[model samples]
Target: MKLDFDGIRLQAPFYDETHREWRDSVVRPFIDKEIVPHIEKWEKDGDIPLEVYQRAGEVGLFQTGYSEAYGGVTDGVDIFHALITGEELARPGAGGVAAALTVHSIALPPVINFGSEEMKKKVAPGVIKGTHHISLAITEPSGGSDVGNLKTTAKKDGDHFIINGSKTFITGGLKANWFTTAIRTGGEGIGGISLILIPADAKGVSRSSVGPKQGWICSDTATIYFENVRVPADQIIGKENEGFKIIVNNFNNERIGMAAGAVAYSRVCFEEAASWAKVRKTFGQPLSKHQVIRHKFAEMLRKINSTQAYMDICGWHIKNGTPNAADIAMLKVQATKTMEFCAREAMQIMGGISYVRECKTERIYREVRVMAIGGGSEEIMRDLACRQMEL
Candidate 1:
């Protein structure tokens, strides 16, 4: 029983030949050649080079689920293609690699969906081509999940808006060419917020690194500051005070991608543990021969399979234009919890060997907390789900 990477994936009817060709020909080869080989060095250096993004762009990795007018491949693409791309990216077990390369996934959608035609034309092509980078700046130093209370402000001043305040824990912040930011434009709460695109080179816009983090090491995290930054009023992503709806919509898609990645990471943990259990001797024989160790594998598989099914159902809802935020939120919680459990059990099975760097399980073990907290914390997700349930 030799379990390879693809062998661990649970087969589902949702995927077709397009998804398989994407996995087998495009993403898997790219990960093996580009990401898997250099992940250790990139993780150690705390950054992935921009060239990798350029290459990813060249191969249409960033084109999925996007409009063809903006260099995206949306003719036959759906949510499943995006999910497959995300899952294969996680196969290397370095979440940061996926995080850094795909930061635009969260940043660009608002611009595409609601921005002016000129704004979309200006921003989308370069980013999709991987020649430019963008970051979503919503989480502030004062708050994380509480977007309604964000303190960042952009005051109207003639033809331009004067922006102030700061954002923290922003993925891809350090290298971003533009920030799709949330600012208070009205009064208070969700109604006050609006999304704007701020050029990183704009005067009064500055950033500093927020490392060394516990995990996602290869992805550069940052605290970005805006001191009386000025931008054209037209830079706003949507109508003033209506950005909350855009943000919520973005969150649903982001959570779906995160859920897919989390489940894939869990599978990676299971694979590493199973491989180790077969070879590493204990007592009088291999660890897999022991009942206790065998049970661990069974438990990991049970969780992984269940989470994969939940993710697929959520993806289907999204594809059919009937996404339930509550289910997506719960699915994210389910996937991250599964990743957490699998990483722990894999560590226990591998013993001290799992504690060292360069080991996928060890790296994933460090990343569990971020996965649980980043998209929306487990606490917040549960609360959101319950609110949607009206219970």
Candidate 2:
């Protein structure tokens, strides 16, 4: 729906005529017809049906920035196309549902970028069509951000690798049919890491939902346990022990996408609060009449606009093929902080209504922490940015 206030928008340099058309003709309609109507139900149910993903795929939502060989548009699809989709999806203000539908964006890249032709042939079509759900499994029970310190081990046997480890906080874990998994095949260090594509139904593979948490309630967050799970050696992505770089390469896009989502979510909060202020009376006067309430909206927009600008700049860099990883990290940090601020202010402005599950602002309020922590934590993002700057 129209989630923006007064239809006001700061110019996004990254988007063009094609992007606008896609937003109007593709993204917007898909969300209205498929997502907005069912979001609350999915949230309460704690899982979206697989058919939603299939439908999203049919609408070309999952294939926008991918290759034509794998069901995506071959030409003119770039980072901006992906960002437009991200913004539209986020406008509905359901982070968990977004996560559930787009987890393949993270999971499939490793295959597209590094997997064998056979692997891409087998995996990409199913994922693009939404017949198969895939997820990136990196974080473990022992460590969340410390990729090098992860304890999951993969031992090679005849034509296969037996994996023994667990991944926690896995998005789409419960229903994912494939997982681009991180494992240690060598000594303990960053150099020891490897990426493997594991079949979710492989023997010894089991998963249980992480149950409920602070946010993303509709996303099927889970703990995936692999006890000597055997994956075909051919499923190995990229060079052995060089998986860390592949994962690292995926981060910039992931973080930027997350940042874009956060910014849109922030806008939703701002719009919800501003609309509420017009009708919400305090002391026999509309809340918007109060200078204090007016200032909150101003402050929220300030952050939202600046964050959107920086996010667009990051997207530009990515499109130009000169993406700076650290900059993307900082943008993610900025966007999440902005989202957090707007969610709080929106909640404050909306008062009691913001605390309940019936409103968009309230759902976004609970989802703020996940935006900051997932993809990459704010603390980690800052540190990563500084290190990338060689500070």
Candidate 3:
């Protein structure tokens, strides 16, 4: 707790004085005053307050990388600045709240990349201002990890496309004003997919909560059903039958984000364990004084520092638009391994206290599983890396 980010030095020329200052001045204050105190309540209640989004918008937290015309920052996108925000927000307490608040990141890219200017004007501004919420629908209850096999269909009918299928585990589904959806638009396989910007209020579209999850307790998850919901042809994003590639690219970025979150959680574990070791007595001295305990702490630090290095390099390549797929895949694997190891070490170091519900380390341990499973599983990442090598 006393140490600054002394470990993960932002020595890259990419991050300048302004980026560090923004983190210190703007983001830190919001976390201290608004988020830290109420986060526990949000986790317990199963969702954050609705006002959190508008409050974030008022302070410009949700609009950093977007266009000025759409109520976001007018300057060019700051990749490092985004990294700082992602790391800080991930550490701010509730995983669910952070995910829901930033769900717009996943929902906006395709629209900005391919939607008509009129479509951007219609949705981006309201979403940026926090007046509207948007969610991305891709994973279905039938099978999430297998995207090509999705059964959701959108049949063309003159001016409209009638969509039918269900998407489950949709973040912000219950509250979004719009949804960036993936639908089967052609014959079969990945080539048949298309993206659409569907309004939440469209007829025949219904949503309900997807019950409880093990963690990310503060973010809302839902099952979204579209039974012949009519989406206009104009709503299609980019060219038809090109959605699969878009979704794949999107997942690569999301996996990196999830990797960053995992590292942040590992840091949380280390900090919690460090504090407990200092105060807790074992035998005749503090836990930190014991050689065995010190070694465990060292192991945890090694995993965390190593994972952070790989993730930082991956972020660097991504910011530069470099094809470092191997790094991205490896980072996810390394970071998740670090998280899993650190969570276990933390629990061991804290003994009974780590097992209790009141401790954050315990919560983080439970959260790590979903991180590995979602975005893409660890086994799947290994397979992807092998294929990238053409092995």
Candidate 4:
């Protein structure tokens, strides 16, 4: 009778008992108290309030993958903890909230990886405390999945670098207190790119709200523009020309998180459809009475189950720091497909209610497009997987 995913093979060799307790004590309670009640309001409002993150921080939800010295409970890429967070996050019915709250996961990693001790002392602790919002900006106006083609340029003079150009489809952009922005410092292609931390309050920095959007309204998507904004040279993350590798690595983890969220989202859709099939009747019987409907539900379950297994495998590899790029890339493709498939079938089972805002399925259906598009597109994921495998 329990609806939660008991069969989920989390592929966690890394998650010890402490992480499991963290999931039950911190993650699940936050979902029940804060997210579930207000998610529909957030969807209608087109953005989650900043207070949500503060609350997440208050409860220690925002501190994972951060260090003990900076008010963070965990350090390094604690993949299992992140996965648990993503799984619980799936219950919110809005991927936007999940993405928006967790933007720091991508945004701060480069800084933590490459910044000075003073910078880390100043930034990471404040951000971990939920008083700050950070965005990872790599996608330029001209480039979506292609990070190397980004045209936004950062030119250095004196002790400062002047940043120019724009970025679009930026999750949490409208609300970010600071940005780990990708900019061109050299000539064309990958070697030319560098990342600089751009404070939102900086001069020449501007943002505009984007989207009445397909989904993720709970996230404040925006387009940001920089017209020769001056930043201190120390704001640069790592060496100027070394950013391409950082961006690529950042993307792989982001994609893995997306894959995890997608798997959880698919499970939600399947659970909803399964429940509906037993209650909603046609021809004087429940929808499950029909063999065709049963088959469809079975297929949906199969996809969710299959992708979860594969994602678990990838997660195990990542936890131990032996990531196989092809495996993770394929997980991205398969997981997104599962989300899309389950969303479609859940709608079919629920009928008219599913089409309306009354049911969570409509929101999820709109969101499935983004899972396929963001963190790298499905097409890009396939090519990368194939290239890595030499297939």
What number of clashing residue pairs does each candidate have, in the order they appear?
0, 0, 0, 0
Cα-based lDDT for every prediction: 0.93, 0.89, 0.82, 0.84
Cα error, residue 109 of model 4, in Å, equals 0.7
Per-residue C-alpha lDDT of model 3 across residues 1-391, encoded as one tens digit per residue:
3622334332455667877886788777777777888988888899888788878777787777788877888485565666677677767535676687888888887787688899999999888878788888999988877788899999999999999999988999999888899899997889999999899999999999989999889889889999999988999998899998888787767778777778877877888888899999989899989999999878888887787777777777887788476668778888888888988998998999999877888888888887788777888888889988999
Estimate the TM-score for candidate 2: 0.97
lDDT of 4 by residue, 91-150 (tens): 666888898888999999888888878778878987898889889888777878888889
Model 2 lDDT per residue over 190-270, tens place: 999999999999999999998878778888899999998988888899999999999988998899999889988888898
Query: RMSD to native for every prediction?
Result: 0.9, 1.6, 1.9, 1.9
Of 2 and 4, the candidate ranking higher by TM-score: 2
Evaluate residue 287 in candidate 1 and report its C-alpha lDDT on the 0 to 100 scale.
98
The sequence of per-residue lDDT tens digits that candidate 1 reaches over residues 313-349 is 9999999999999999999999999999999999999
* Candidate 1: segments with Cα more than 4 A from true spot: none
Least well predicted 10-residue stretch by lDDT in candidate 1: 1-10
In model 4, the worst 10-residue window by lDDT is: 3-12
State every prediction's TM-score relative to the real structure: 0.99, 0.97, 0.95, 0.95
- Model 4 compared with the native: what TM-score? 0.95
Best by TM-score: 1
Cα lDDT for residue 236, model 3?
94
lDDT of predicted model 1: 0.93
Sort by TM-score, top down from the best = 1, 2, 4, 3
